[model samples]
Target: MASAAATSVMGSVIGKLAAMLTEKYKLAKDVERGIRFLQEELRSMDAVLQMLAEKDDDQIDPRAKDWRSKDGGIAEEIRELKNLVSEQSERGKRYYDINQCLTASAQPVLLDPRAPALFQEASDLVGIDAPREEIIRLLKCEEKQHKVVSIYGIGGQGKTTLAMEVYHKITEAFDCRAFVSVSQTPDMKRLLRDILSQISKSDFDQSQMLETVEQLIRTVKECLKDKRIITTTRKKAVANKCCTGIAAQMYEAKPLSDEDSQRLFFTRLFFSGDDCHPDLRKVSDDILKKCCGLPLAIISIAGLLANRSKTVEVWSNVLTSISAAVEKDSPIDKMKRILLLSYFDLPHHLKSCLLYLSVFPEDYSIDCRQLILLWVAEGLIPGQDRESMEQLGRSYLNELINRSLVQPTKVGADGTTVKQCRVHDVILEFIVSKAVEDKLCYHMEW
Candidate 1:
């Protein structure tokens, strides 16, 4: 148990160091190499800890102090690493990748290529037809204007699915059309080439493609003249840049109505509620309320419950577990699987920044300014050159917003700046679970 605890702590420190290495990035190559070596060693330590963990709990000797080093070199080594990191911070280096890293990197490995809910049959895609049709109408109505209409909203709101439905419905109206995914890290040159080829119905050669935003715009205009192009991305910022010279409109995906939410969840769980016991229906409704009209959450939970036997006791126990888990509970495989993609895509600095949000309760409204101040107090947002930690913190928040991990709930009157934000309950659950796993922080609920 002692060895396991030590390994866990070391692992957390190593993770923070890696995050610093990526975002802070001030140390010399040798220091950077040292951190990597330590990271590998810590991973090995975790393995040893796991072996120790596998021993019978009853057989474990709490009095055994062999886990501590006799030579005392381990403590000294840790102190040295800590001092190196501290020295780097004391030198006053600041974040420099705001302009560069904010955009998608050239090559990004999407953690999971297949999102199950996104691929569900159209008939099974409850509550999507209305918004999907309206978006298509807005796009088709302005056909002469060559407009770019985007469906934007928080993650798990079915933006991609809605956009795809619209894309398929409207494809026949245009001579050429392409549907592509813009990930957290998007290679503009490569993505554009792929889009251009898909729309042009040819094996487009890219041996000498220029790599500039201006060139990308030129290529699209020249090749896809008067032809509709559609893309599904997480943020309005990316949508605006997708076709800068063209008319771009953002259509926010509406939350599923109460009726729709329950209907979809119930249908997925059972063919009809008529066959269910009266008590089961009540518990099902409670579970659906927790889903909060987010299709991903509802579908995920329904998928989780599908294999289980339907009984009042079973449903009630499931409800109690989900309510307690506060996003981490219930078909955890569903919640964890979907949310991990977004989590893994973030830079190391942002990892802690995003997870710190779990300290707030699920569905709690966070004032943007106050959140920034708290981050400053916690020293999570470091100062950048000529930029206050406040400014850097705000940028970090916006970056999270852009990445679709943190959803902005209310905007300022100008409708441009985010005044308030909230993490999706399902995502908040993910943050809590992860923070616990990383030993970053803990939450206590009565």
Candidate 2:
């Protein structure tokens, strides 16, 4: 536990060092170089501590202890630390082959990739159809004049999903269209480049040739002529900036209605309340009452319950867990408590798979194939054969999607497979915190 706490502290220091290297800090080249040096050293120290923590006293070499005690000469201490680092490296290579751990029969069946799309459509959105229509009308895609609209709201209000629904509905009306999520730390060059790549006619990577932000923006402006664009952000100020000097409108996202909330809640668990067991109705209602009409909150709780047996005893236990875990706190804390229930319920392998996603930046769309390859490379996937490994990876992803832990973004050419996906900002935030606490990933806020 002490070593784990040390690892957590080291993660924080490493994150701070990373922030110092960013352009915002304006760190000098030499100072930046020095910080990088310390970064490497601290990381090595972190690994040594973790390796030692996993060992029994009798298993630890006396020389390592002497070095830790500062009883050895400088040269001796350096030599011992290097040896420990080497040992740690070797230990890391000892991957737990998941393929050997469980038989193929034990694996859960893969969820249909299309299952996640149930909530993506306007009709499936339950309460937000009016907002979707209003935003589309606001775009005025039929008009020759280009127009901009921004959907602004708190995280988890479905701002991105609402904007995306509108984009899919009206996208064909325009000659060219592109949708990109602007990260908090906006990489202007990359942002402009992504926009061009999406909407540009030519196959060539147009943004690659342009080195400066100005050139990319100029090229983007040239391509965006007479195009309808919609932007979503948490802050109204940022939304207004996205609308700067354009015919623009701002729409605030609202929570799901009581009736719609119940509909969405049941849709996740049973797809309809008629299918729900009579005994569990009261507990389900109590859970939704706690959720308070937040769509993400509803999906999360419903996902957690979907796999469990439909019984009052089981449902009541989950309700009690949520109540016991959270007080009459702020909505954010309540949401976290709900997410915590889902996270804790996951099997060990899925926990690692979910936490791996914290490496991606917020609002980033992740490719399913690429993510699967990453899981295999990280030794997170295990199977007797290569085919099974890939199959298992997809199953893991589908399970998360079905549980509403991950959001499916793009469908494949076949129209049934979820080819691309992204984590909701609220879920991403929660995952990052858990990742940092477990030392599974490192993150820093500037």
| Candidate with the greatest TM-score versus the true structure | 2
C-alpha positional error of residue 124 in candidate 1 after TM-score superposition, expressed in Å: 3.5
* Candidate 1: clashing pairs of residues: none
Model 2: colliding residue pairs = 99-382, 99-383
Quote each prediction's TM-score: 0.46, 0.68
- Report, for all candidates in order, the number of backbone clashes: 0, 2
Give the poorly placed runs of model 2, Cα more than 4 Å off. 1-105, 112-117, 120-122, 141-146, 199-209, 218-227, 244-246, 363-370, 382-384, 409-420, 444-446
Candidate 2 RMSD computed on C-alpha atoms after optimal superposition onto the true structure:
14.8
lDDT of 1 by residue, 1-446 (tens): 45544554565566666776774565556877887887788677656566666676556565423554221455445556666766655453443444345433433222111122223367666787788778877667544556667665666777766877887777667766676655344566777777777766443554145668677768776776655555655567776677577676667667789888877766655545565667677788888877767776776566446536778777777677666656554433434553564466578988989989978864567999999888877879754442466767877776676555666666656544677887766577788889999998976643
- Give the lDDT of residue 32 in candidate 2: 72
List the global CA lDDT of all models: 0.65, 0.77
RMSD to the hidden true structure, all candidates? 21.2, 14.8
Residues 139-256, candidate 2: write the lDDT tens digits.
Answer: 8855687688988987777888888888788776766677887766778776777777777747227567767888877788877777777888889999989888988898888878
Top model number, lDDT: 2
